[model samples]
Target: MITLSGNTIYLRALEPEDLDFIYTIENNESVWEVSNTQTPYSRFLIRQYLKNAHQDIYEAKQLRLAICQQETGETIGLIDIFDFDPKNNRAGVGLVIGSQSHRNKGIGSEALALVIQYSFQQLQLHQLYANIGSDNEISLQLFTKFGFQKIGIKKDWNRVNNVYKDELLYQLIQ
Candidate 1:
């Protein structure tokens, strides 16, 4: 699915124009916990990544989309379907809004709904999963709202600021 639309937002394929946006997000330390990123990335790497964004999910085993506002067409975030296993009909889903000001406004909800539809319907996937930090109430609620159940929790899974935290595995089966 090249583009998946919701009422207020849409998911579009990553484009060369998104190089700066992707670089900013990749270097944003605030989102490192959710993205499992330990260090910042340079623009050269991001540009090279964008160059390979055209690979299909089956070929690349992942799909990253830019989340754009419907009204203004300004990209606000990104969503990903990674570890795609066509033989198993399952994949991992994750998303992040670039700014705090753009969060908690139902933008993520809309973006996720569209991806879920695309994953399950167009992609013909049987299930999707997300790894969320235990302390992340917002993400927990959002996934649960879409029927993703918490299957397990890994204790001391992630270290943030030298403190270990639990990571919850949530799954949505079709």
Candidate 2:
């Protein structure tokens, strides 16, 4: 099983049934800045994505997992290991809790913990990285809590609404 579970949340591979949840999140204009998404994704495209979700991390060079609540079994967010480099033993991590109501509830924290362990112990990865907007205090706090240090800042990296914002690169090494 690829599922990683914690007390509050679990991370599992994307499922065909998650089309609606993933669709809504991918098309949310408000979160485009965080996700670096510039356009909406059609259901047809998303369905195609789900069909390919079974590809292993090595084969796909990326993995997207659904974050679900342990109690309710409700899928609430998504987490990813991207830019996987088996030769270098590293990958990039990104996650989004689809709803504001679910933020700050420790769900992301638990989910991140699972990923860190899975990456380091299971995957034997040397490091993981995350790029975060400088203005995102919640994400800054969340990533820092896990000992991800701010390695550098990319000035004017992302342009949102005609304003260029700085993006911070954070890294964690096992």
Candidate 3:
């Protein structure tokens, strides 16, 4: 398992014990916009997914890591490397802090730094990208703080509450 630790938080591979946390976050309608969740997930389905959570990222083509507090070992958020393309040495990054209380803290920043370091150094990736909704200023700021430049925009990319929203593509090239 890969564990990347920081001063306040650490990123670790998913475990069977995280089923409830994953299920709750996946089904949270308030966050569905960013997560692209269409419907609630059943516990059975989540259990099945957790059973295979240990698969290698090379085989799974994506990796979802839990962001936990270093002191309490409580999961506060998740960071994912999706749409992995090893041949191109690039992947899309997705992150969520799970609740409003967790937002605006330094947790996401620390986790992002750890993930970027792991992606570039351990995974040997050349670049990493993030797709953030135009209205999500906090996330845009977070990625930009790490030198992820705004590469392009997908006009009216995501639909939320029956309205279309633009999605910005930010990239960090190593």
Candidate 4:
């Protein structure tokens, strides 16, 4: 398992033991709304997703991490480095704070910073991109705060709550 540490937060690989925490967050409607994931996630589905991720990890195709509080050691969120392009040294990033109590605590930013450093330094990735829903102001602001530029927008990219919504694409070139 990969581990990253920061002043206020830390990240480690999501293990089978963390599945319950993941389920709690994945099933939350508020988390799914901004994350473009379906709510009321079942254990079977999460297990399937984890199985796929485990396979990818074995193949060295992806890096999926669980974000947690350094002091409490509580699993609060997840981060992924996906869509890896080795030739271009780039990858796509996604993050979700599953625990409502952890929201707006600077933990997410800390985790993002640590992961970006890992992606660029350890993984030798030259760039990273994040795609967020247009209406997700907090996520947009968070990424922007990390120097991610608004590259473009995809119209009607996601169908949420029975309505089409735009997706804002942001990129960070290291």
Candidate 5:
């Protein structure tokens, strides 16, 4: 995977050494709520996730990258292109800005732009889509700022905090 940099953010392939950071971030309830990942994250789980990412990359099923601060090298988030259909030239995108301190700092937007550039320029993907929970207004707005159009909403598609929530599907075509 290509390491992309801009402003104060940089993205690189998710490494095994990043498990600790991933564990800390994903374990936070605030972070997990927006992500809809209810299971408590641990170092062991992160290792497994990284292993799966490695396998997926080799098999061309998906690509995962870690978003870090350029100067400090602290892992702040993760971005991924999943459900890739090479024949159709399309993929699903996922992102999580793990650090609450980093929220609203524009880092997520920059990292997202970098990932889109990589998807279109390097992976040659023609379309990228995001499935976001209706309650995740921040992410919805974030993707919207990047030109992703709201295609439709999936009724009661997700269960969060013991309640069913709709998922809004958005897409950006290159």
Candidate 6:
């Protein structure tokens, strides 16, 4: 099993025990805009998803990892590689720190660094990209800090609250 350790945080594989934590994050309406989540997720659906979490990334075409605090072993966030295209050697990345209390801490940054290293070094991926809403300045900054460059933008890409917002495309070529 892969365990990415940082000074203050670590990334680990998702487990059945993460059901409740994932449920809370998935159903949180406040964070839906960034995730493009329009409907609430039921516990039953999440439970089924958890059962399939063991599938290898190459077979599943996606991977979601739990972000944990180093000393206390508390799961504070999730980092995902979605829309993985092994043939193309690329994938889309997404991340979320479940609560506002975890925001602005170095946890997210460290988790992202570990994921990038794994994607490029272990997975032998050529590049990683992120689709970020224009209003998500924090995420944009976090990704950009890791050398992800703005590649393009989709105008009116996501609709939130009654208005459409632009989505920025960022890419990091390894």
RMSD of 1: 1.1
Per residue, candidate 3 scores C-alpha lDDT tens digits across 1-174 of: 344899988998899899989998999998898888889999999999888888888988899999998899999999999988999999999899988887888999999999999999999999999999999998999999999999999999999999999999999999
lDDT of 2 by residue, 101-128 (tens): 9988998899899999999988999999
Q: After superposition, how far is residue 98 of candidate 2 from its true place, in Å?
A: 1.1
lDDT per residue for candidate 5 within 1-174, as digits (tens), equals: 344887899998878898887788788877665566778866776788887766755386888788989899988888888888988999999888876788899998999999889889988889999998888888999999999999999998877768888999999999
Models sorted by lDDT, best on top: 2, 1, 6, 3, 5, 4
Q: Report the number of backbone clashes for model 6.
A: 0
Q: TM-score for model 3?
A: 0.97
Which candidate would rank higher by TM-score, 1 or 3? Answer: 1
lDDT of each: 0.94, 0.94, 0.92, 0.83, 0.84, 0.93
Candidate 5 runs further than 4 Å off: 1-3, 56-60
Model 5 clash tally? 0
- Give the runs in model 3 whose Cα sits over 4 Å from its true position: 1-3
Model 3 is weakest, by summed lDDT over 10 consecutive residues, at: 1-10
**Model 4 misses residue 118 by how many Å?**
0.4
Error of 2 at 84 (Å): 0.5
Clashes (candidate 3): 0
Q: Compose the digit string of candidate 6's lDDT tens values, residues 1-174.
A: 344788888888899999999999999999899788989999999999999999999999999999999899999999999999999999999999999999898888999999999899888999999999988999899999999999999999898878999999999999
**Residue by residue across 5-58, what tens digits does model 1's lDDT show?**
888888899999999899889999989999999999999999999899999899
Please list all clashing residue pairs in model 2, or write none if there are none: none
lDDT by residue (tens digit), candidate 4, 17-101: 8879888877778777666677488898888777766665326667889887778988888888888888888999988887667
